[model samples]
Target: MENRRGYSVYQIALHWLIAVFVLFQLFFGESMTTVVDAVENGQPVSTTDQALGSAHYWAGLAILALVLLRLVLRLASGATASANRGPRWMQLAAHALHGLFYMLLLATPVAGLLAFYVGDPWGDIHSLAKPALIVLIAAHALAALYHQFWLRDGTLKRMLSPAG
Candidate 1:
């Protein structure tokens, strides 16, 4: 088997960290939305739900910081080159997908922050950011699935294993 280029330690760390944050944001953000809906419909918000909402809010802020750091690390390290063994169209698609990933990743959290500031009344700051995050997450997930299943080009593996 051929050895692939592994991602730098910093890149690996950032990737995993962001993955965790994104996953957490997805779950917790949805939970907060449910809580808000329940309250609006004259249902009581459970203590556990309230706590989760608060946690999500604080976590979102932390995610913002980590994202900024990741962006800086990305700029300093430069981006990985696309795997060279694909068809021209596949290669182009991979590049476009990656570009979209970065754009959505950056935009999602920023939009969430903006939504928070714009008076979303969930009282849980993170819940307010869900609308934007949902769009980004959907985009990110679809792109990943496309590369992994449709393209079968190992673009996902590149990040999962190491950079080449």
Candidate 2:
């Protein structure tokens, strides 16, 4: 699809794509570890098991790549005007939540890479942060829905589509 004048389609797609992929990882990352456990426990590991085991690392890397792109695009495009008419404190909280999201998104996967590839202990840090990330994600999604429904504002719609 062609890029819109204000909200670039690339940005929109990346945002949602990364979101769904990350959410998938959050929910199902443990299942990926089962492949390795099966082998460790003397259970036969199928080719499919190995492939699925690799997905956790691959998906983390994918999230890193997409988030990097999203950051760049967000900076390049400049964002649309705030549709938030909420209090100043709410706005500050929103910015802080967003900043935390970006930081964790980058740090977690990089830590995973370090642990897997370099035998670093940072992998534990990423593991520890998973629950935190889930909480943040839930808050973010809830806030978006609140803006869309409770506020009856276009803020969430703006993220959904640039034309909003």
Model 2, which residues run further than 4 Å from truth?
A: 1-6, 32-49
- lDDT per residue (tens digit) for residues 35-88 in model 1: 657866889888888888777667777777877887787677666665565578
Full-model lDDT, candidate 1: 0.67
Write down the RMSD of candidate 1 (Cα, Å). Answer: 5.4
Candidate 1 ranges with C-alpha deviation above 4 Å:
1-6, 34-44, 120-157, 161-164
> All candidates' TM-scores?
0.66, 0.83
Best by TM-score: 2
Residue lDDT tens for model 2, 32-85? 556545755888777765776588878889999999998888777675456657
Full-model lDDT for every candidate: 0.67, 0.76
Error of 1 at 93 (Å): 1.8
